[model samples]
Each structure stands twice: as C-alpha cells, then as structure tokens.
Target: MPPDLDPRLTPARPDLADICLRGQVAAERFVEGRPARIAVPSAPLRRRPDVAAGLDTEAVMGDAVTVYDVRDGFAFAQIVRDAYVGYLPEAALGPADPAPTHRVAALRTFVYPAPDLKRPPIAHLSLGAAFAAQAREGEYWQLASGGSVFAGHAVPLGHTEPDAAALAERLVGTPYLWGGRTTLGLDCSGLVQLCLESAGLVCPRDADQQERALGTALPPGLDGLCRGDLVFWKGHVGMMLDAERLIHANGHHMAVAVEPLAVAVARIAEKSFGAVTSIRRLAMTAELAETGAFTPSAAS
Candidate 1:
C-alpha cells in the first residue's frame, strides 16, 4: 500500500505486525525511508552538513522532524518506500505541485542528489508533488529539481507539465543565501531550482546541476551564452537574461537583482583574483519560455 510501503518504514502496518523496520519500510522502486509528517513540539532534526548517506537510518535521539520544512535536500517517506519525497533540493509543507503542472516525471531525485553533494538542492522534495519531465539526451528524462542535474534510478516525471517561465518569474525577487532555496530567501541555483520545480520540472541543486538539464554545456566564453542562459563561477551561478545582462540573487548584490553579465563577472573575477569558471544556458526549455527556443547564436 502507498506505492511501496514495505512495512519496514511503516512499522505500524498490520502486515508487518512483529517485523521491525524501525519506523521505516524497505527500499523498493522509488520508495525510501523518511521522517513521518506530523507536527513537532521542539527543535528540528538538523543533520550534519557533511551528512553522507544513511540519513534516514541514522540514529534519531530527540523528536523526529515532524511538519516537514526541509529546504536543502530531498526527504523520503522511509529511509529506504516512499523513495524521494520531493526529488529536488527543497521542501516546505503540503504538496509541491503548484501553478498547475504542465508536465510530470516519476524521477525520484535521490538518484542524483544523494551522490552529488556539490548538488544538494535535488534533495529537497516533498511527498506527492507535481513531477514534469521530458526525454533528454535520448535516455534520462530531465526533471527540474532546483537548478541542477542528477542521475537517478529508472524513474520518469509524469506528463502533466507546468509553465517553467511562469514558475521562474514567481520567485523572481527571492533573496540569495549561500545555501538556501525557499520563498523567504534563496540563492541563484536555489531560485532556479524552486522556479523550475514549481513547473513540475525536477532539477538538481547546483550550477553544475544545471549542466545536464540543458543537454550540453556551452563553450567557456561569454560569447557562447545567450539570453536566459546561465553562467557559473565556481560555486556561484547566475542567469543570462540578455547578451549584456544577467539576473541572480547574489550576496554581492544582497538580493535578487539584475546586472550586466560582464559587471558581475568583473566583480567575481576581481574578488577571486582568478579566471571565471564556466558559462551555460538555462535549461533549453526556458528559452521557449522566452524567445520560443529559437535564440540566435551567442557568437553573433
């Protein structure tokens, strides 16, 4: 019942009776062990920042995280039947499907976020949210989890998709935090991820997380990036709204603001005292959200 509730995660299940799943079910298909959704009375369950794997199964001393509000990584219903709760690196409460999904994918984000710590945003997903995905690189159907790429185990977003641009615009003025992804505040990649997830596009939680979502990386020069394209500087990420302009929720700007792409680059270059890392486009689909996806070559 409940897709893959293996009675392990659901220790209360009548079927398990004497079976001790330790308040969780076994990992079957997309199911995973996660904290039960209930209201808590005290401090939240904040895992170690370096927490690698065995998250759901680790020791829980105090009250478990009830009333889910994770904003960093995906959470599951069980450590191993409820697969990935959101499949993206962010969660609030209630369902994640918003703005009316236009596409959906069954991709559980744990496939990517779990393995790529640099791309943690993919971990913030909720139970039963809208999923939107399409065929990408002929194999994995790209899901929009925050703003990155993640490899997963045989899952696909369901068909009812939502408008990505509309979703992206909704979170336009959200603030930027080094590692935040919520309406209260968010970083560049966080904004991108939440915006896309709102549209049912499951994505990862990092700038590099954006690479596969776009299918291919743009050549490293500024000339290769176009309007709506994204650029990455080591840990930093921004969106190229036009040839000369980009928008992002940057700590430098202290909020979600727009500036010339070159100016931002100059600032970061000046700050880091080194060469910019790389430049990339927003997910290929977003271009359709603007110029109908027929953008001219940036080389022009």
Candidate 2:
C-alpha cells in the first residue's frame, strides 16, 4: 500500500475497499460499488455513521457517488466529483439515471412542485447542484425528477463562469460553516472549491491539498498579486479580490467577508496561524477532468 494515499480521498479501508484498488491495498473484501446520485438538496458526508460525527464535506443534488457499503442507515461511499470518501445517509441517495443536463448557476434557488411560481417550493438547490431538464415551460424548466425550477437560475452543461473571483464576490456575507460547501455556509477551502469548480476548474477540498495540487506558486512577498490569486496559511486559504483586497470565509467574522490583504496577513499572524505559506495563481489552463483523484500525504 502506498503511504502517500490520502485517506480522506481514498476508498480503501481495512475491511472494505473499492475494487479498483484490489491490487494496491489490503482489504478483506473489495467490491465494484453501486452507482447512485444525491437525491436530497444536500447531504452531509460525515466521518462516521453517527449523526454527531464530524462532517467531512457535503454532497449536493445530482452529485454522483459509488456506494460501497450500507449499514445503520448510512452508506460508505466515494463522491465521484472529488473522490472524497465518507458516509452519507442512505435515504439521501436515489438511482443514478436520467443523467444531469443542467447545473444550478445561481447561488441558491427554489424548486417548485409546479411550473407556476405561486406553487410552494418542493426543494432548494444551491449553486453547482445538477438537474436534468426534460422540458421547458414559459419561464420554468420542468425537471426530469418531477419538479420545476426557474430556468434562468440554471445553465446547460459546459457553460462556465467567466472567473472565480467574481463568483466569490457574489457569495460575500454567506455564513461560515465548517465542512459546508453550499451558499448556506462554507469554510475557506469549501469556498475555494465551490468557486473554482463553478468556473470549470478542479480544486481539492482542503487547504494543504489545494496548496499542493493547484496552480503555479508565485514568488514570495505577495507582490504583484491580482484577482483570483489564492493565499494560503497552514490550515486556511483565501482568494484575492484584487491587488489590494482579500476575500475569504473565515471564523473571525463567521461569514464570507473582504478586507485589505495586509490587515488579514497581520491579524492572522498575530493569531498564530503562521505566515502565508504560499500564493498560487490559477491560470485556468487545464480543463476539468472527468474524474478527480488525489495522491497526497495524509494531512488535514
């Protein structure tokens, strides 16, 4: 077994492993996982089966997953989007079919039971949630899963945002929730992951992993920084709104907020987060791969 494999992203466990890793890992049983999709609005992927267990991340509507095991109402699965492995509620999953054709582009939107706006909402889909549109009414897109969503809030597959910084700007003031990934809440890395993924770039879920896998590192000292540059601290990450301003989902404000980069640097240092470890510039040169897998030393 390769010690470099990150447990957070690897599907191998002592008792079970994804069949793809049969030769690479030691497991009592290896199985070809069953395909599934997140049916609920958003489901927490927790580190353990218990409700009180720590949340690793979240899987939103239409996200694909491969279920390896089901026990105690929780399914041990690997999210196909990022290869993140965790346990999510079995009830939140539905058959993976009627492939998604559109992605929610709005920060948040409501899905109505009928095409009429007057109808009560059946569910709320956040940015990056996927849904297949089977038909279009006057102003609504009838979903393949039996609901209607405002057509303007979603875009056809392959449509990409112009830039991630602008997208991050629109999310300012959203509450900061550790392990969250939706507009409802999100942490530093989660915010980065959301914005980058929306812009058609692949991003890792944790700060350290992102620091390693993301764009080219700039020369030290934060000189010549521009919009969309990523700043990293040991356990934290933030994006440059521009040369002077920094935007981040931080605990200091408990919300996504902006401030001068120098001020943030000073305060963060005073609080013992250490200095900026690296500054990365996402050139957007690489396209998003069909499958995102990770190989990093276990950390975070």
Pick the lDDT winner: 2
lDDT of each: 0.43, 0.88
Give the lDDT of residue 214 in candidate 1: 45
In candidate 1, what are the lDDT values of residues 176-290, reduced to their tens digit?
6555554445677766665555455555655554654543467768874565566776766776655666777788767777777778888888885245666655555445536
Write candidate 2's Cα lDDT for 39-71 as tens digits: 989999998889999888999999999999999
RMSD of each candidate relative to the true structure: 15.7, 6.6
Clashing pairs in 2: none
